[model samples]
Target: MNGKIIGGFLVLSALVAGAAMYYLQVYAFYRPVEVSSPAAAIRLVSLGGVQEAMLTSDFEAIDADSSPLRFRGCFVTPMTLAMLSETFETYEDPTPLNAPPWFGCFDAERIGADLETGAALAFLSEKNIHPGVDRVVAVYPDGRAYAWHQLNESAEK
Candidate 1:
């Protein structure tokens, strides 16, 4: 009947729209960030308000131009937490943003929990890296580090 056909069409349309939305959000906009890109640099803010680059290796990153908060990075730093804490301004509150599962390196939940338990230390990578977003970098004792851009207090207000 006509009613049945119309209902089926509506259901089909919704399913198609859902699939497209998922694809765009999870895959379309993101691109592998190259080592040469500024986003891949692991720099922290020094106590004197200067941004200093740290010694980082095995860097892997992903970014999406669609939003400033979409930048995420994973790397290893030779600098110990003791030296880093002494050298840079520590971030009082650090919350990491989740990356797509395909990326596999940056796990926001694990990083956040580590920060809560003192298993990792978070540093202010760059304040106001975007208009109202701050770049935060959290490092574990084993030299594993992850970076992400998050909304600052100003932006949250």
Candidate 2:
């Protein structure tokens, strides 16, 4: 009886551990992938006196067959993510379907590509489309540009 009970308990524990690991891996799939670039290595000084910096290149920009431009950046801070959510609410157009208010329409595939690549900075800065942040820049395979916000001389801590 003692041997049977111990065997059952061990099996139950293993099952539970396996389930937990599976859940964590699935949840982490949506999380941003780490990226690296010289342009991504800079500190942002906000008007609110907040010092923000990127620890890794968590953003990317990729081209999708459907959209003219796609924007994707990591949601590292709640504030930055909240700002993006707000942009979707106020800036997104209703009739065109997935069109950025200031920029033209893009397909979901392109958006997904942007998310995969990390081009959020460039999308906002181009054409002087300011979303009211510290800096907005876009990098291409060829070159990079500071489209909106200026950079400050602060190292990433």
Candidate 3:
């Protein structure tokens, strides 16, 4: 009877720890990013290597202090793809990071697939936003856009 009690206690303790870990990783650290925040700006790197703010609207974003890669934003841009491509430096590789499911606007898998098929184009928002991490924006032809922070080549090296 003592052994049974000990085994059940151990199992319950393990289950509780696992649940707490999941909650902390997926839900605890993130916070809604306000429009007034600098992280909310939808800026792109110009051909001249300057970061310029683009005209964006309906912006909704979330970020976490825990990691630079935790930023994810969804917005609408009035700028056409043609104008942007001609003006901004295109990001050769844009890997969207997964956002917590509660933040429904940003979908990393869909954005990544769109980029791969040329359904969307990725541009450098800001280089080295956080040491080796960069801010990348991916836009569809219809002006639907998303942004996320990813590790740059320097970080990889």
Per-residue CA lDDT of model 1 for 1-157, tens digit only, reads: 9999999999999999999999999999999999998788779999999999989999999999999999999999999999999999999889998899899998899999999999999999999999999999999999999999999999988
Give me the displacement of residue 33 in model 2, in angstroms: 12
Query: Candidate 1, after superposition: displacement of residue 40 in Å?
Result: 1.4
Model with the higher lDDT, candidate 2 or 3: 3
* TM-scores, each model vs. reference: 0.97, 0.22, 0.98
Q: What is the lDDT of residue 134 in candidate 1?
A: 95
Q: Tens-digit lDDT track for model 2 on 43-153?
A: 443334343452323243222223222232322322343343333221111111232222322243454354356543232222212222133433333232222232222
Alpha-carbon shift of residue 113 in model 2 (angstroms): 16
In candidate 1, stretches whose alpha carbon ends up further than 4 angstroms from where it belongs are: none
Candidate number with greatest lDDT: 3
User: What is the full ranking by lDDT, best candidate first?
Assistant: 3, 1, 2
* Deviation from native of the Cα of residue 124 in model 3, angstroms: 0.2
Task: Show where candidate 2 strays beyond 4 Å.
Answer: 28-157
lDDT of 3 by residue, 105-148 (tens): 99899999999999999999999999999999999999999999
Consecutive 10-residue window with the lowest summed lDDT within model 2: 88-97
Best-matching candidate per TM-score = 3
What TM-score does candidate 2 get on C-alpha atoms? 0.22
Residue pairs clashing, model 2:
59-118, 60-117, 60-118, 60-119, 61-117, 61-118, 122-137, 122-138, 135-149
Q: CA lDDT of 142 in candidate 1?
A: 96
